[model samples]
Target: MEVAEQRSKVVEAYIQAFEDRNAEAVMALYADEATVEDPYGTEPIKGRDAIYAFYQKAMDLNARLSLDGPVRVAGDIAAFPFTVRVTVDGKRQQLEVIDTFRFDRQGKIIEMRAFWGPLNSQEI
Candidate 1:
């Protein structure tokens, strides 16, 4: 697979998969030993199963993801700015986030990093 050509497609799929609350579809883009570190500072969940579980929990909450800007691709990594809106206890919250996905030669995401923090989120 061509990394440059496929990276944006995979990123778009990821956004759709998450918005669809389809953890399995999200996992399908990951490598067997992929890692995910949402928000970047905490411990990264490693391996496919762990990553799936992580996404499962969030998707279960009915999180909706939408791109805020164009996806940027550089070498093996693709980055995008987005907003995740979810309702908690009948209150809607939105978080502004940026995520970087590093792809393997086969075009599967090998590592995913999300950049966000408390300041990036607020009740909506």
Candidate 2:
């Protein structure tokens, strides 16, 4: 398969795993040394363990995800915008964000970044 096609599948699986709240399945999509910079400006979580922890915390929120638009793939990279709705401590929130992934030659994500800020969130 072409690099873009392969990367698209990877992205699809990542999204599905995330929505399913299956941390192991989500971690399977990343390389050992993968880094995730969720929300862009914060320090990136480095390596599989750290990334696993990050996803674990997200899953604990019981957020439901939906695509804001289509996934776009170019070469070994993919980017997609999505929304997450969750209720935490009886407070509902909706997050609108775009996430980008850079895949390694083996098709595992080496880098993932989420683009969102305070203004990107809304109380629901």
Candidate 3:
């Protein structure tokens, strides 16, 4: 299979893993040295261990993700828009987000960045 096809498939698997609320499955899609920067800027979580912890918390939030649009693949990166339904502080909130995943040669995600902020969120 073409590398681009493999990369695109990885993106689909990522969405499925999150929908399953299976952190381990999600981690499988990442490289050991992966880094994640949720919401573009803050502090990036570096390495697999840290990345795992970050995702675990997100999983614990009982977050449900729905694709808002198609996944766009360019080179080794995949970007897509999605909506997240999660409960925080006893309130249900929805976030409209776009995330980009940069994959390694083997198609494992080596970097991930999520984009969203107050303007993209709403109390549901």
Most lDDT-accurate candidate: 1
Q: How accurate locally is residue 74 in candidate 2, as Cα lDDT from 0 to 100?
A: 80
Off by over 4 Å in 3: none
Q: Put down candidate 3 lDDT per residue, 43-114, tens digits, no spaces.
A: 988998888888889999999998988888898799999999999999999999999999887778999999
Every candidate's lDDT: 0.91, 0.89, 0.90
Model 3 whole-model lDDT (C-alpha atoms): 0.90
Per-residue CA lDDT of candidate 2, range 41-114, in tens?
88998988878888898899888888888789987789999998999889999999999999898889999999
Per-residue accuracy of model 1 over 20-44 as CA lDDT, tens digit each: 8899999999999898998799899
Off by over 4 Å in 1: none
Candidate 3 structure, TM-score to reference: 0.94
Q: Indicate the residue-level lDDT of 74 in model 3.
A: 92
Colliding pairs, model 3: none
TM-score ranking of the models = 1, 3, 2
Clashes (backbone N, CA, C under 3 Å), per candidate, total 0, 0, 0
Query: What overall lDDT, based on C-alpha atoms, would model 1 receive against the true structure?
Result: 0.91
lDDT at residue 55 of model 1 (Cα atoms): 91
